[model samples]
Target: MMLASSCRRFYADGSLAPWGVLLAILDIWALVNIFGKPWDLSKKLIWAAIVFFFPFGGLILYYLFGRNSS
Candidate 1:
């Protein structure tokens, strides 16, 4: 009952949540950049998996280390 009420508030007026939308956009951007690099197939797959599994932390780690790695 409490969970349902909170969910309704989150999706009030059929509008999406702001932070959720921003996070999704950021994640997609990370995925695109991840696949665009000329990285080895195995490495690419590993990064992609990390982003998929841990979207927020993955973006941070990718920008910090993965982007500069060749």
Candidate 2:
């Protein structure tokens, strides 16, 4: 309930701009990659590429293109 209210407040307040939200999410993604379960070399390399080259853009792309669940 608290989490849900906070998320509602977030959208209502507009304190979190889209880019800022994207940055926060990307930062979390990088952290998750660093700490989460181990992956195969290729998968780790892919995540490293996303984390290093253009973490923000990569995250935005993932959100837009890869996260559309039906």
Candidate 3:
């Protein structure tokens, strides 16, 4: 009961759990890589949108395909 309440409190304020933090870090990494590349503006914007909207899958797609393309 108490543990459940504590967890609810912890998650109530939009705070991230451990996996969420990891996903955020990966998203940041993908964003940085997307910006740092010499791709054109439209391409960067598209990738940024993908990373922003779909954090985990976007990051994976970027790392697997986009990174080597740049």
Task: lDDT for model 3, please.
Answer: 0.72
> What does candidate 2's lDDT look like per residue over 1-70, in tens digits?
2112223334556565565565666656664654353655666556555544555665555456433422
Candidate 3, 17-66: lDDT as tens digits: 66666667778888888999999999999988877777767787888888
TM-scores, one per candidate = 0.75, 0.37, 0.76
Query: Which runs in model 2 stand beyond 4 Å of their true positions?
Result: 1-25, 62-70
Cα lDDT of candidate 2 equals 0.51
Error of 1 at 42 (Å): 0.7
Tens-place lDDT per residue, model 1, 1-70, is 2112223324656765666566667878888998999988899999988777776677789989998899
The worst-scoring run of ten residues by lDDT in candidate 2 lies at 1-10
